[model samples]
Target chain A: MPSLKNIAADLPPVQKTRRVFDGSFMVLLVLTLAGGVAVGVVSGWARVGQILIETFEFIAMLAPKIGAGIFIAATLPILLPRERVGRLIGRESGVRGLVVAAACGAALPGGPMMTFPLAAGLGVAGADLGAMVAFISGWSLLGLNRTLIWEFSFLPSDLVWTRYLLSLPMPVLLGLAARAVMQRRLA
Target chain B: MNILIGTVLIGSGAIWLWWQLPNDAWRSASYRASLDTFLFTAPRVIVALLGAGFFAELLPEDEVRQLLGAEAGIAGILLAIALGPLTPGGAFVSFAIGAAALKAGASPVAAIAYVTSWSLFSTTKIFAYELSFMGRQATLTRILVSLPVPFVIAAMASLTG
Candidate 1:
């Protein structure tokens, strides 16, 4: 129900081609290739083949969730814009603000590239340090997309559940701590 | 079981969010963004997952057990935390490595610490994204406040198990 504010039209257009094949991406590719080669050399080509085959299988299994995650990440901002986000969690929003910010962070999908900008935008729109901290902490600790799609896939169900449950309260606590720290500084 | 639940929940969320778009223009924008995100994310996921698989095979299982096994205690948690920020690549890379360590006899507490620390302070994310967007002071504040989280989470996790 929030609309975007401070849309920076002067911001340069994203270079789509460069984005997909940047230096980091190249490094990642090289590392994977090198790792595969080293493993093949040390463990045998058969093991490398098996691993590559398994990797494709895992990719196939993951395709649907990844698709869903992409959709949410794209569509979410439309529903919850900076103005609405800032209004609800502005600097003086207190405990309720922290809770809302944390929940938004947990529910908001995407990686750091997506999150950090949103946090900056929200800050300009009026979110305070506490809310900002809560939002980032929530995303880092309990992002639904990351936890459900990736974490569950790799870790055991019980361990994932244990960690997830214990972490549920952390973002708000951190937000509160950040607020208190800021207050002390001001006082 | 976890996969099924996750797929169902996320699927529903995506569908509902899709239906909520206000108009044709909004729908078009959303689609465009989704496509771009897919372009950016897919390759990274594929390459990172593959890298994780290869690295999993190479990990020294005996050494891991000696360092992070149940008997390793608090030291293992600290070591795991230290490794989290230093790891390169995406979330899957860290999670996959954590899983590999778990399979190689790493304690659950240690794994918890590793994942949490990575989530909070992955050096790559901090340097490449956070510092650039949020600026130095805010980033530093967030980091300082978050310093204790992984340790506390690991401690709580250890208590129940």
Candidate 2:
């Protein structure tokens, strides 16, 4: 009888395929462009000119923050080393790791567009699944940016605090749940 | 003196022309509503930027990546999920981080889980903008609705990954 190792070794390598732009995305893009053209034509050249000016004004208003975000994103990879990140948050073998993982997850910035690429790069550099999950989890729920803005704007302090308090434990719960699901599948 | 005068004349003429443009009467209501939304949301954007800067300064990315990459067993998976919100950058940025974690040996399931949670269940944005703009009921409903999406998506992705 063949050994388990031998049987495993004999299995065919999984073929991976690159994700392509799906029909929905293409359709959406086409529709958007068509709409823009229709609006411009219907509105006339003067209106189109006004629209462009308005668009520029909007861009100008957002330029500073957007520019800073871009700069920070560019520098993130260099600032954080892969090995150190792995060592600190990747060892998810027990309860301690789980707690640390949750904390780490709540700390990262931006949304998936920025975090996903960075996480992938880290994976390429040799990060683990647990750490990746923690990082992703942390990025979603914890927002120092949102907190300060709401606080300054005269929104309810209680609401902000309650949300923060409630969110603190969610990542850990989600992580554990995900683990159970994954394990069940593996089994 | 001549150049300064020319510049002033041009600037004022440009402003006058812009102000004189015919406005869309039909779309005005919707446009105004969108403008109101923008005005209401502007402060949140400012706060988000400041928070992003603070995150960049405080928690080093290298440290974060390492934690997610090493010895990720069941516990690690749970930890990663929990940390989804705190991770820096946005959805696109987090995706990159997810990719990096995967390259470093993170499981595909955990990575997908992290991405889903990161995008859909942000605590910081909820407290600051979602709750305030839409009110507690709307915010709570969104959070409740969004909470499960990542797990469902991640579980499915895990099977394929």
For A48-107, candidate 1 gives per-residue lDDT tens digits of: 989989999988988888899889877776566545666665654778888888988888
Q: Please, what are the lDDT tens digits per residue for candidate 2 over residues A27-100? A: 43454345445555665556545544554563464444333333222222223333445456654455456566
A129, model 1: CA deviation in Å?
1.0
- Classified by CAPRI criteria, candidate 2 counts as incorrect
Indicate the TM-score of model 1: 0.91
List TM-scores for all candidates, in order: 0.91, 0.39
TM-score of chain A for the candidates in order shown: 0.84, 0.55
* Highest lDDT against the true fold, candidate: 1
TM-score of chain B taken alone, every candidate? 0.94, 0.51
Per-residue lDDT for B30 in model 2? 25
Each model's backbone clash number = 0, 106
Model 1 docking grade: medium
Which parts of model 2 have CA positions greater than 4 angstroms off? A1-32, A41-47, A92-96, A102-106, A109-114, A117-131, A141-168, B1-118, B121-161
lDDT of 1 by residue, B41-68 (tens): 8899989998999988998999999899
Best by DockQ: 1
